[model samples]
Target: MSATTYDRLVEIVTKLHDAPEDRISPDVTFAQLDVDSLTMVEISMRIERELDVHIDDNELEADLTLDATTKLIDAKLAA
Candidate 1:
């Protein structure tokens, strides 16, 4: 993924987690960020609304890390 895509992921994750942008990393897990299922769903919805991309539950489950999530968003944007 491009650096901008990764940066966008970090921004979105930070917003969802209510944490500092620097606190989120590619290696960090969502669980470690104390993000619950409902929050995850809300985040997904926000991404869809903001980015105009659809991300299903399975994709969210498969892409747990920030890097993976960024890649997924990049792919959707490309598509």
Candidate 2:
């Protein structure tokens, strides 16, 4: 995955969840970060708004890591 994409995802997730930047990493999953369903929706919306990529709510998985999420976003952007 692109470092730029990973960095932006980390920024969005950290800000939305009020999580410390240091606590988030490419391998860390949303579940590990204590991100709930509501927060997942919020994250999806924020990603669409900020990244100009639409990620359906169903597409967001709590078990997905930041690296995986970045790859998804990259695929969407490519499509």
Candidate 3:
């Protein structure tokens, strides 16, 4: 995934979850980030609104890492 997309995801996650930027790595999972279902929804909405990409809810999971989400977003953007 592009650094831009990864950076943006980091930004969104940190902002929404009140997580420290340093704690947010590509390998970090949503559960590790303490992101709950409600926050996940907010993240999804923010990604769509900010990135103009649509990611289905089924595509997001607590076990998903930042890298996986970035790759998913990249794939959607590519498509």
Candidate 4:
């Protein structure tokens, strides 16, 4: 796993979530944090801009966890 990638994601998520970094974990999902669909879209946009990756809404909605999303990013990068 890329710690830098994970850390960057956590940074972005924490900022968007308006919560502390410590509150986020690899296993925690966005729904668990009370992040609505709209915010999830915003987060997806931010992630694409910041990470220079293409993540569709469906893929994001499918797995809103740090671990799973990071894996998705890795898979995208691999592709």
Report the number of the highest-lDDT candidate.
3
lDDT of 4 at 53: 90
The lDDT for every candidate, in the order shown, is: 0.77, 0.91, 0.91, 0.80
Error of 3 at 60 (Å): 1.0
Model 2: per-residue lDDT, tens digit, 22-62? 77888999999999999999999999999999998778999
Q: Report the lDDT tens digits of candidate 4 across residue range 1-79.
A: 6557778888778777776656688898887777788878888898899988998878887346888888888788788
lDDT of 1 by residue, 1-79 (tens): 5448777667676777786656678877777677888888887887788777899977786238877787889899998
Across 1-79, the per-residue lDDT of candidate 3 in tens digits comes to 5559999998888888988777888899999988999999999999999998998898889999999999999999999
Clashing pairs in 3: none
Q: In model 4, which residue pairs have backbone atoms overlapping below 3 Å?
A: none
Models sorted by TM-score, best on top: 3, 2, 4, 1
**Which has the higher lDDT value, candidate number 1 or candidate number 3?**
3
Off by over 4 Å in 2: 1-3
List of clashing residue pairs for candidate 2 = none
Top of the candidates by TM-score? 3
Task: Output the better candidate (1/4) by lDDT.
Answer: 4
